[model samples]
Target: MSQPQPDPEAPVLRAEGLYAAYDGTQVLCDVNLSVGVGAMLGIIGPNGSGKSTLLRCFAGTLKPTAGRVLLFDTDVATIPVRQRARLVAVVPQHTTTSFAFTVWDTVAMGRHAHLGLMQALTERDIRAVSSALEQTDCIHLADRLITELSGGELQRVIIARALAQEPQVLLLDEPTSHLDINHQLDIAALLGALNADRRLTVLWVTHDLNLASEFCERIVLLSNGHVAADGDPLEVITQRQLAAVYNTELTVMTNPLSGRPQVVITASKNEARR
Candidate 1:
């Protein structure tokens, strides 16, 4: 009888007891999370919740003051920069390059991990870059200058660049920040399609809990440097929890269309005193 084969794809990213800080001030505390292959995990929180910091830690850009981040069960610190880039790709909130590179050039740069230094672009790289641009619906803007594109166009280009990496895991920090509703839905649909077709593990940060609930299978809600809630969107995004974490009155209800948890913030009624 043939020996049983081990499951090759498992949890690709794990954060254990992660405590992070900047300039000696702690921003994240004892946060633990994991992303299995093909999973899309959404991170949501109010401002100052350290969601961006958490993404940085997972991307290996920021070292945790405490705890560890593991990639494929290996310490991320042990992974070389190039190898890590191949395994994980990031679409940061602000993607501003000093030089004025064309969109094609920027997108093709994602293939750097697969190419040796001083090597020419392979046919595979060209195909991947083209596919990425098409997936992000930015193929028409391919020849446009990076600085000439609008916010949404530029964001899609950056996302295409990350997709060109052909990474097993993808990370996006506030991907919908400057996008319109149409582009936001477009990107969300693209992410789902990519995960289903390519088995990409995604960890995305969002301030909009409704979008998080609609797009992700699981969510991690952070508040003041700690995970206040971690579970299904319906269970975790209750009115009480939202009030406590965000310091605002919110109505939590099932979305009529998607049947997912929908959060609506209500402005405070208390009047200011002289």
Candidate 2:
């Protein structure tokens, strides 16, 4: 692939005074964020803090109540859906719909934005799907049924499908929710590699703060419908900030190997008394 354009210019994504809510309840409050080309940004917050809600705005699934979302300095709403699909892909937390399609067929669906309703998979599309499977190390499961695979296997397939979109921006929501520790590490490694090698600009919402700190260049912490903090992972994942947002006591330490922040949840005094 050709070298991605430099980041000296405007950011690939910018949110200014963004506000979003549900059922007349505000979820995000005047959020301002900017993501440069090839940047890896992690979004973390307590439940109902609107990490997913903010992502929906960028994915064009949820319209913002106020403010502007610019893709390449152009309004996101003005971009055609097909054009937007080519620019961004979302890997959801989990997919529960039962479809008996083979893994290859499921992944090929990512190309729909580029093909007619009745169009067959062209050579380019096939190559793209195959390459995505290879990148995620799921090529061996290409012929397997989606319903028959384990959660981790299916997660990789979904990520592969997103990759097949050949998107410049990748948005992942709770990608490791159903995975074990090993799978979590594997997926984190893959994401880090993709960002480093392919220059894929990534926005990830994860509950795993340690993984986020290890893999992301920066992190945005949300709480009570506002951005509580935004900065380098080490700078943002402090014990005070986490305790306040998560409503729990926690110890923050630095990983000696990676030099990233690590969080250890502290037990409540009542529990400790036991």
Compose the digit string of candidate 2's lDDT tens values, residues 1-274. Answer: 1335347476999988999989889998999988899988899999999999999888888888899788888889889999899999999987974879999999998998888878899999999999999999999999999999998899999999999999999999999988999999989899988999999999999999999998888899999879999988878999989988998767999898978899876567327547
TM-score between model 2 and native: 0.94
Q: lDDT of each structure?
A: 0.87, 0.90
Q: What is the C-alpha RMSD of each candidate to the true structure, in Å?
A: 4.6, 3.1
> Model 1 off-target regions past 4 Å?
1-9, 268-274
Question: Residue by residue across 169-233, what tens digits does model 1's lDDT show?
Answer: 99999999778888788777888788767878889898878788898877899999999998777
Q: Best candidate, TM-score-wise?
A: 2
TM-score of each predicted structure versus truth:
0.92, 0.94
